[model samples]
Target: MDLIAKNLSYKPTDQFHLNDVSFNFKNGNLYTILGRTLSGKTTLLKTIAGLLTPDSGEIDFDGKDFLRTPVWERNVAMVYQQFINYPHLNVFENVAFPLKQRKMETNVINEKVIDALKSVGLSGYENRKIQELSGGQQQRVSLARSLVKNAKILLLDEPLVNLDYKLREQLREEFKNLFSKGLADETILIYSTTDPRETMELNGEVIVLDEGKVLQVGPAKEIFENPNSLKVAEISNDPPMNIINAEILESEVSFEGISINAPKHFNNINNKSFKIGLRSSDIILNEKGYEFEVELAEISGSETLLHLKKGNTKLIMSIEEVMNFKIHDKVKINFKIEKAYAFNSNGDLASSPFRSKNG
Candidate 1:
């Protein structure tokens, strides 16, 4: 099923929950709403699921008005962070509940119920009570419930939030592989979360939300590599992109009071003022690099986050290997000039006026 949201906004009392937002998703693709907490990610999902009606705007599904349709008749299945389960019901009953409510045949219900359980790797535990399962297992049971309904449109609101790291990763792979094997391009998967693992690795189209506004939306790779706004870059990455205030000159760019060859993107620009963004992975520290004072170094597994302070900019550098840089370490940091991006004071990307193939 195709989904389209046009200029959706929600305001309750004095709070502006959602701003004017618009986007469309075709069948057979996974789309993720990515933003920081309180960024209206969940609100957008709820609005789409018909749980919260938009104060203004329209929702269309395959050219039909879905906002006006009854929730049950919308054929949209949702698995939310706060799972819905009948505390009084057993696992079997809970999984079969939706089908039973629809009054499907006994044979059909049994077949679909078992199939759903197997799909979620929750086979053979159907006889147990809902409270007997662990948090992850219970979440799987909830997923099975969504699958059993055979709804073409699926909405997942941080469904893995309650699960531990290992279970979450494993389950993510399971879902991805299942859908890939099926290759159903007609089934739309809309997941709302702040996890880069969910949006970036899954190749989902990311819709960046801030407060109630849809700041940006695009393919995962494009958006991550070149975020239009500083807020977008900060909210979209694990280590966040490094931003340095660099003064543009006739021959090159200046950072930390050091100058480098004119970058390919700026090979022709005569502008004297601009800001440059360098991803953590793009920063290289060497004796011959640009000198910036390191204020802090954070070690995370194999990567080290170097928070450097130079002049007025605090640039974040993502180093691949763990380094023993102390606080206030004076070091030279270099970047892949061609791969770097330049943004103006207004947070908009500005390509080098000088045309270069490297950019």
Candidate 2:
């Protein structure tokens, strides 16, 4: 099934609203909705599930109008942040609830429920009571219940948010594998998350949202490397994208007490002032670039995060190996100019030198 939302807008209250959001998605692909709190991720998901109607615009599924379709008639299933299961029902009974409601044959329901349980790695736990299982296991049961329904669209609203760190990591890998293994090959999977890393790990398409607005949508890596706007560059990154204010001259751009050759496309931008986006991974520690003092050093596993500053601008760099650098230590750092993203004074993407090369 193909899903399309055109100019979707919703205003439930003054605090939260979805403004002119639009996107096109098809079955057999996983999509991640990324944003901070109150960014309308949930609202958008609910709207797609037919739980909330839009004040304007229309939703089309496979060229059919879904705006007026009832929630139950949409063939959609949503797994929320909370694991909701009947305490009195066993795992099998819980997963078989929907099939039973449709009056499916007893033998067929048993086969489907068991198959779904095994798909989520909960095999042989069919008779386990909901209250007797661990939190992660219970959540698996919930996922199995959703999978058993075999809905055309599956909406996961931070379903792993409540799991422990280790369990969340394990489940993330499981979910990714399950989706790729054709368990729901013909299903449109929409997963919501606040963590940018989660979107990267999923390695799929992403839609960046902020304050009820759709900022950008594309392949995860593409959006990360070539954000369409300053807001997109900010929300699409973890530790956030490092932004520096700069001024464009005729042939050079000046910022942080250094001048670099300007891209030819800069001549088209009407504004002289601009913001440069540099990902932490794109900043290199070398002896040939600008000098900056290390403000802090954070070591995590096999990687180190260096917080460097020059004059008034702060930059963060992630290095694979541990560096013996202390606070206030002066170090030379350079940028991979080809990887830089420039945004105009109006916050829209102005120039990307490497976009063509990557395209």
Candidate 3:
């Protein structure tokens, strides 16, 4: 099945709205909606699931209009951030509820329920009451319920948000393996997450949304490495991309009492002012670049994060190797021009010097 949303817009109030959002998704691939809180992630998923109507636009599945289709008729299963299983029922009954609703044979429902539970690593918890299960176990039961429905589209809205960090990590890998193994072949999975690392770990196509607007959509790595706008660059990074105000001079860009050679694509834009985006990993500690004082340094696992400042601009650099640098120490660093992203004064990406590598 293929899903398409054209010019979808929804406005419940002035503060929250979706504006002219659009996308094309095919079956057999996982698509992630990456955004922060109140960024309209849930609204978009609801619209696709036929739970909410778009103020203006159309939704089509395999070229068939589903704008007016009833939620039940859409053959979609949605799992929410909360564990939504029936509290009064046992795991087996909860997992078998959807099958029973469809009036399947008793033997078939039993077989399917057991199989689904096994797939989610809850093989022997069938008779356990929902109230007796841990948070993670309850979530597994919810996932089992969704799987038993055999829906063509699966919508997951931060399904792992309620689990502990370790459990969330485990389930994340399980979900990815399930999809990759073709267990859900021809099924369209739309997952929404606020964590950038989660989006990256899924290794799927990503749609970045903010303030109800679609910022950018592409492969996870592509979108992160070549964000099309300033908002995208900001939304795609966990620590946030380092943005510096710069003026495009005659062959160089000047900022914060320093000047650097302008990228080839920006040579024609001389005299224009723009914002440069540098990833924390792209900022190298070297002896041949601009000097800055380290305001703070933190060691996290095998990596070191140094907060450096020069004049009024603050930047974060992630160093994979161990460094003895401490706060108040002056260090020299260089920006990897090829990895830099430049946005115009209007916040749109103006130049990407290394985009061809992805092409």
Candidate 4:
């Protein structure tokens, strides 16, 4: 059965939290809602879970009206970013809470809780107290609790967001393993995250949200490579794509007084002013290129992100190695003309490097 949400809108105040959102979520598929804070990712999830009602929308699940159903009867499970568990109850009891609330048989509850715990790699942590476990383990407990329900719809709202970096990486791999191994074969899983990297790692159907609106939805890679608009490109990218105003004249593209031979991807387009979108990785350091002063340099992990400026243009380049550079340091950089994306003046994508034709 598929879950269909049509024209969902919820405006509690002056702004719309879910502005005309609509999508069909199929079973046995993982969908990621990618957005920043207050982008309505949580609002959409809560509305689907029946935790919050929308001001206007139609929710259909298995050919029935889902919005009409009570939250307790919706047969959905949600795992929050924070570790949520009963402080007085141990792992076993915490996971068994849902089944107990349903007054399920003792034997069935025991079997289900054990299976859920095993699925989350916490098979032996049943008797451990909540306070006695680490943050990751506690999250596992929360995950096991959600998994125990075996709900038709499973919503994970940034479940690993609070964990340490190494732990988050470990759990992310584990999650991919779990989801790919048919553990949720009968459920529709919806995960939300602000991390573009995390969304790419999951490699699922991606729904890009921005300011309470659904900007674009497609395969994670497609959305990454061919963001429909400027907003989608910015939100779907980790460091946000660098945008620069440029003009196309015959076979050349000019920006900030610098001109380069336009790639074949933009050949069909008319000579006009367009916005160029380039990923940080697409810009490279070259000794024979234009000189730009370093505005800022940030070291993250094993790479260095250099922010540079030349004339009126600014760009960020992602260097593969861990290098040190000071502010105002002069560096020569070149654009990978073949990897540039062209956006119309209205911010809609006019051409992409991955696409053969221009709009």
Candidate 5:
């Protein structure tokens, strides 16, 4: 089912859970909600599930107000961070509970329950009690329950938070594969996470929320490479966009005691005082480029992160090659002039003819 929320805001204790959040969730797409704890990620998911109503907004499901419909008729299933199941009930009973509630035929329930368990890789363990299962198994059981319900909208609120690192990675793929089963006409997966890997695995549109405010919502590539505002730029995990103060003269840009030849487009900025952003991948350790001292180096397997300081300004750059410098090592940094972003004093990004805004 396609869901559309407009002007969604909720105020419980003078503090809002959502701040005029608006987005149209496509029918058959895996959508992820990314934010910190108090950023209203869970609250937004709950609002969609009909657990809590927005103080001022409307949720439309195919031109009908979801709020006006009864909660039971919303056709939405929610799987939270906790793996909740009937501890006394066996896996089969737990998986078949929703089907029994709907009073489906015995043969049909058996077919659907077995299908769900098989999708979660728990086909032969149906008679085992939930308490006898591992954390991952129990979480899979929870997922199975949601899947067996045949709900259109799947609200997963940090469902893999309790699993260990390895299991978390493993289950992430299993859950994603569940979407291909074709159970519903359209399944909209609303996953909430602060982990970048989860968002990376899903590889869909990402909505970054900060303290109950909607920072930005767009495809992952556009949001990462061409953020329209500073708030969105601050939450990027791939080396938060490089920002440095720079001044544009008649035909030159001066920064960090280095002046580079500026293009004619530099003179057309709407504002004077602006900051320039450079991606980590764009800068290199070229001897003929700008010079600086490497203050810190963080090694993360294949790629190395270098924290370089130019005078009092510090910048982060990532290199695919192995780290060759130690702490306090002086290195000359070079960057491609074509791969930079200029933003005005208001933090609004400046247009670059060389770079598309939707990159």
Candidate 6:
């Protein structure tokens, strides 16, 4: 079974919530919708779940017209970013709600509920009340509820987004394990998140959205290594990929007052002005490198992100370890030229180091 959306467009007002979005989602694959807030990730998921009607589009599932189907009959389950559960119901009741609604026998409901709870590591907490559980546990209950249905379409809209960082990380790992074990092999799993790292961890097919428009779609590694455009690179990265104005002249790539030999990937290209893209991790502190002033230093977990500036160029450097640095501190840094990317003046990717030379 496959879910095919053709030219989906939803515009309640003047802004297009989903602008000409189209994709063929195959069964049994996990697809991550990665974008910033207000980027139509949630809107797209809601549309698929039959929660939002697109202004103009055709949805077909398993060769049947999906848009004409009512939300209740879609057999699609969605877990929202916020924990959604019936406060009056216990964990078991919440998980069994869908099966019970179908008027299944008690034995089948009990069996399915227990298995779903066990899959999400809440086997012994079946008797616990919704209010008694922590945020992570509550979210697990929501997931268990969806799992019990065994629906053909499973949509998770930032399900782990409201939890603490540590708990989010923990649940992310569990999600990977659960999905990797064929738990929902017959289901189409579509997860939406604004976190690039989370998308990277999932390591699934990625759809990069921005402002209600589709930017790029590919494997997570492909999108990460070779973003189709400048916006894709920025949205696919946490601190955003560092971009600087540069050009190729003769056999050298020059930017600001610095110049480096053009990478072989850019060989045979005509001399012209373009833009250079560099990941934060590709720029490192080097004593014998170009000088830049530290504008801001942020410490996140075990790493340090240093925002440096020199003349008209500014860059963010991701250091592997934590290091303290004050603003206005002079630091020399070097770029990993081989790991750099090139984009045309119009913001389209021209060359990627990950590809073969001149590819």
Instruction: Name the lDDT value of residue 112 in candidate 2.
Output: 96
lDDT per residue for candidate 5 within 254-350, as digits (tens), equals 7878887765445565326567777788788888888888889988767899999987678999999787789888888887666677777778777
Question: How many clashing residue pairs appear in each of the predictions shown?
Answer: 6, 0, 0, 0, 0, 0
Q: Which of the numbered candidates is closest to the native, going by highest lDDT?
A: 4
Lowest lDDT block of 10, candidate 3: 350-359
Give a tens-digit lDDT track for model 4, residues 1-359: 99999999999999999999999999999999999999999999999999899999899999989999898888899999999999999999999999999999999999999999998899888899999999999999988899889899999999999999889999999999999999778999999999999999999999999889999999999999999999998988878899988898988999877889998899877678888999999999999998899999999888899999988888889999999999999999999989999999788999998985465
* TM-score list, all predictions: 0.89, 0.87, 0.87, 0.97, 0.83, 0.97
Clashing pairs in 1: 19-212, 27-185, 28-185, 265-352, 268-354, 280-318
Which ranges of candidate 4 are over 4 A from the true structure? 356-359
TM-score of 4: 0.97
Which pairs of residues collide in model 5? none
Lowest summed lDDT over 10 consecutive residues: which window, candidate 4?
Answer: 350-359
Write down the lDDT that model 5 would get: 0.81
Find the number of clashing residue pairs for candidate 3. 0
Off by more than 4 A, model 3 = 62-64, 248-253, 260-271, 287-289, 293-303, 321-332, 356-359
Candidate 5 global Cα RMSD = 3.5
Model 1 collision count: 6
Lowest-sum lDDT 10-residue window in model 1: 350-359
lDDT tens readout by residue for model 3, 45-86: 989888888889989997679897888889999999999988
Per-candidate local distance difference test: 0.79, 0.86, 0.86, 0.93, 0.81, 0.91
Residue pairs with colliding backbones in model 4 are: none
Please give the lDDT score at residue 140 for candidate 4. Answer: 90
Error of 5 at 149 (Å): 0.5
